[model samples]
Target: GQAASSLGSDGSGYGLAKALKHSVTCIVPALVQLKVKAHPFAKASGVRTEAKVTALIDGKEAASDTGEVQITAYGISGIPVFQISRFIALGLHQKKRSEVLLDLLPEYSEDEVYRLLVKMGDKRDDLTAKGWLTGIFNQKLVPRILEMAGVRIQTRVSELRKSQLQAVAKKCKRIILPIQDTNGFENAQVCAGGVRTKEVCPRTMESLRTKGVYITGELLDVDGICGGFNLQWAWATGCIAGKASVMRKKK
Candidate 1:
């Protein structure tokens, strides 16, 4: 009788009603705040400058003397030309120099690439010579690569001789675009240059110069091509630094 009566009681029903009301009241305002913050720059244009960054780590003094800074729409701040901010930060902490060299294209051999283009032309005689490259490369990139190779887009594929094909292929693959400079710190998500890896222990990420100083993340002279490789490197180095720090504390 008591169990049956409890099911019909208003007390239990009131408690459930109160819980639901409280949940919605708390959740709705929080959601509204998040949405407002997420679109802070919905109407904003251009870049915002950030405060000058300077730090001292492990007895090393590092500063952004250029006083240059920039922030992105997502609230992330960095410099454009120095995309290696993470590495710079790490180096400053470890008292090391930060430097980076970027090679725009690392995969292709110039001579071999040229040969492939030459072969493509010979193989596809029926297609418009200029349009023959549509299968091998993006339409947008075809013209650029051809220009670098000194090949005319209008030339018939059938007209391409072995030597010409070789030249085109070489240019497509070995188009050397030198990195004059990287986007500075404001636009850069991480620093390309940092403490030399040779001086730091890869296993632990501990600095050789200072026993208690641990270097990790973008601070080391290791970079991966675009996509998530840089973030992966950070995660890996962070783990190594954390473990090493723990080990040092244990001793």
Candidate 2:
């Protein structure tokens, strides 16, 4: 109540979605790529090269192929399983605690999960179910208690895999993970390695592999790191391609 009162009438809510949209708009084209030289200075050279990193813009290759260039990656934004489950349970149990438990109890429609919880009687809170026949796993009961068995059985009635849970965690759009080359295509900021640029006419940006098709954006093999160059490339190439598509004989 004190915290709510302190908030006053306007409320302090940040427009995350809006901020993201603006950021994406700014970053879509000028993407930057970080590259590290494997060996800045060979031992034979007798002097270290300082091992500096170069920011490669999309479309343009590294200035020097002299060194081994590697793309850098960032860590994923993932919530731990225990913390996620705790918060989920808290939100679900917010109003009328006992009634919430009763509501959740019926959610475990499967005979096995239902029977397990009923057999445990008053210790039903130790188990959680989400309906459907999936799988049952063992879990330790919360709170330090003696006489009560420490081992408790847990069954997730929802048929969701670990990958699915991770996907769901990202769906909320609140979590942010660094875009990396090793991450799944779904989690990537922009996809790389599409229609080979060699198969496309540099003058027209039209595909030679599949004539009449003009490729642009992340769909092309061209990708940049984190600047607006990608967007600039897209616009420049798209403009030329668009003009090429409707080329007419000089009359």
Candidate 3:
């Protein structure tokens, strides 16, 4: 009865029908080599699932889930994980140990951050007054980051003197967040660690380690800062690798 009612409802049934039609017409065709399977428990719960499996890159043992984990196609993805992947890939290609060194705070000097907070209190009569910070940071993050920096939100910006302002500036610039772990292969968009360039010819992307083994894409360990940089790296590396691979094959 509930299923029948849901099918008859315009808001529910109409939208669902449209989605089904689009999925069938568009999505099905794109999935050329796709595989599907259902667990009995998941089927009973009406849940559908798809999994992409990839081998562990570099042969490092899998990490436990205690830390932050983002799964991806090639491997894990995250700030610390991404940064570390560059060195890891190079090391792996050279058959050396690969590990990531993460810094929780990259920006500020500790003494500078501390001195700034003390000045804010000395300049402001009312320590709780809120002042001008919108120009310096996102308004939403300002209050929270300020609180972390030991400034009361109610403190007036006018109360901050030069030293205090400088201190606050340093803290804002150097907030620390620890790296937990990489988001694993399933959830990651690209792999971090791969073949090292020291062992690969730079211009051609030809492997110095193995003949005919041209490394490219995320497996090469070159990643860029956020935005479209990573995509550009992948495209350039892939193009070079493709050209080099063909040349190697001919030779």
Predicted model with the maximum TM-score: 1
Name the top lDDT candidate.
1
lDDT at position 49, candidate 3: 18
Per-residue lDDT of model 3, residues 133-215, tens digit only: 54433344456556655667776766545665665655554433222222323333344433444666889876664566555
Tens-digit per-residue lDDT, 1-251, candidate 2? 00122234111111221222211111121112221123111122321111122112232212211122221222111112111122222222332111000011222433544345334333334333322111221111111010012221243323334443333222211111112222222233443334456666898877665566666554455655334665787788889887888882231
Which structure is stronger by TM-score: 1 or 2? 1
Please identify model 3 stretches exceeding 4 Å from their true place: 1-128, 131-139, 149-170, 182-189, 226-229, 244-251
TM-score for each model = 0.38, 0.29, 0.37
Better model by TM-score, 1 or 3?
1
Error of 1 at 235 (Å): 8.0
Comparing 1 and 2 by lDDT, which wins? 1
Cα displacement (angstroms), candidate 3, residue 202, comes to: 3.9
User: Any idea what lDDT model 3 has?
Assistant: 0.41
lDDT (C-alpha) at residue 6 in model 2: 26
lDDT value, residue 30 of candidate 1: 6
The sequence of per-residue lDDT tens digits that candidate 1 reaches over residues 97-208 is 4332111122456565555555556666675555977766545446655666576888777876767677666554333221112223333343344456766778898766
Count of steric clashes across candidates, in order: 31, 14, 24
